[model samples]
Target: MEAVSYSGLRKNLKHYLQQVNDDATTLLVTNRDNDDTAVVMSKRDYDSMTETLRIMSNPTLIDKIRRGKTQIAKGKTKQHELIEPDD
Candidate 1:
């Protein structure tokens, strides 16, 4: 994440917009008078983050993810090809 003042962002809006889109960078806009702040990020990245949050909110899925990480750390994982189902 990159931090920039409101004025700075407005001054270089085009450049920062490119950074957010191309580099998948997040921008934190800060204000002087107030504690208000804003974040800017790509739509794709935002969607991905929301999806991850949705998955994490499920207790069953969270447990499974934790177990998988433990198994990986214990070197109990195997290499296998993932076969997708035909539509």
Candidate 2:
């Protein structure tokens, strides 16, 4: 992550945006005023983070994942045929 002042970000908005997209990094736009901070991130990163949050919010899904991992560790696994969806 990188921190830049609000004015600085405004001055070099294009460069900052390109950097965020190209480097897959986040930018923290800081303001002198209280609690006016903003964050800039690539869409891909944002989507990934949101998806992770959604998954983490589901306890049943997380428990299933943990159980799957434990099953793999214990060598209790089976392979199945892939089911392709009709186009």
lDDT values for all models: 0.94, 0.97
Q: List TM-scores for all candidates, in order.
A: 0.68, 0.83
* Clash counts for all predictions: 0, 0
Query: Which parts of model 1 have CA positions greater than 4 angstroms off?
Result: 63-87
Clashing pairs in 2: none
Per-residue lDDT for 1-87 in model 1, tens only? 889999999999999999999999899999985668999999989999999999989999999999999999999999999999999
RMSD of each: 3.1, 2.0
Tell me the lDDT of model 2 at 6: 97
TM-score of 1: 0.68
Best by TM-score: 2
Q: Global lDDT for candidate 2?
A: 0.97
What 10-residue stretch in candidate 1 is worst by lDDT?
29-38
Model 1 lDDT at residue 26 = 95
Query: Which residue pairs show collisions in model 1?
Result: none
